[model samples]
Target: MFNKKHYKFNLNSTFAKLLGSYLIIISLILTTSSLVFFRKYEKLIVTQEYNLSEKLLNQANYYVDFNIQWATSFLYSLYLDEDIYDLMFSQSSHYKKNGISKLKHLNLSSSNIDSIFIYNKFDDKFYSSLGSPAENYYLPSMKNIIYKSKNTFTDAFIPSQIKINLKNNNITKNIISIAILTSKSSEKSLSSAVILNLNANTFSNYFKHNITNNSNLFVMDNNGT
Candidate 1:
């Protein structure tokens, strides 16, 4: 009978060093993959957020610009109407009365328009859309403004936060008032003005009511007031 042979395991430098290096390399690869994925995901999220913001801004601007163009064109047409010319120069109260009557029936009643006034420099008179003469007291405050913007359109009244009576109600509100010098080649050059008073609340509410959030949308004037 032969004795059984015994076997023993050995720990060598070459094998141990190679195993340690392999583990370190595998750990490094995993860390690099995680870092790359995190960076790309963060960039994607940022890009999406930027695109959304741009789209919203463009939409807001489109609505604002459209309203402005519509208002401007309407005012121009009112000033150029054939009957308004007679009202500007006529000394006869009857002609002025007839003109006022015609203006009331013009169907200029839009959601944004509160009232309209035609001021004649020659007669120093004003006709209202209400089929009456505007009070003389309100004339002095706005006379110089109409003259300064001769043959052009400008802000007739600046918008403010001050409380005032509107439609028989005392409240704080903003109003958009514009004045345009009417053509008067037959009498005096640019001797008349057509003023349009806009209901700013109606215009601004159009934007706010469409949104679910209680966000305020401000329509700023050229003066930023």
Candidate 2:
């Protein structure tokens, strides 16, 4: 009297229908949630990275402006000194001695300039703040600035590759030489030049310590070498 086979068939059919519906509905909900989360997380990560990059660029710009200000200040100050005029017009052992002393003092006091020199074209000798008798040497580079500048002209930065012989010793340095063209009187004639050597590495070192260790900074001479 009991129809066991028919009863079993009905039970299996009911269970299969319920399981199919449950799988389909649950899969749809999970896939939708995963899609939405991925898009939001991706946008957040991209935004954060862009902001960080902009901040670093701003920091670099600030440092560059600060350096330029300091450079102009020091160079203009040297341009205004009257001792340079005396060095050119007067020639005395005592005068030369005092000149060297004054130069050495100025070099010591300056925070940004490394060395200063006033080259007397008439005497054909270079006098430096370092107190080392400037050597007579020939350089195969642009000579127009040395010969032609009539006003205060700072030469474009020239990266030092060839060692400059100072006191008979050679050294490689990155420097900018500010050429201060002088005249005995204002008559469109330049009598001599005062060269101010500014060390580029000094300014870079200031920010290098404060900036992140990963930040890369380089200072080169006018030649871009």
Best by TM-score: 2
TM-scores for every candidate against the unseen true structure: 0.63, 0.64
Model 1, 85-181: lDDT tens digits are: 6676677786676678766765366767655678776777787675422333344434555655635677434342325454677655455667777
Model 1 ranges with Cα > 4 A deviation: 1-35, 105-108, 130-144, 155-163, 166-168, 183-190, 206-225
Summarize candidate 2's per-residue lDDT along 113-154 as a digit string, tens digits: 667777665665567776533322323222344654545565
Scored by Cα lDDT, where does model 2 land? 0.62
What TM value does model 1 have? 0.63
**Which pairs of residues collide in model 1?**
none
**Cα miss at 89, model 2 (Å)?**
3.9
Which 10 consecutive positions of candidate 2 have the poorest summed lDDT? Answer: 133-142
Best by lDDT: 1
Off by over 4 Å in 2: 1-39, 133-152, 155-158, 161-171, 183-191, 206-225
RMSD of 2: 6.0
Query: What is the Cα-based lDDT of residue 133 in candidate 1?
Result: 27
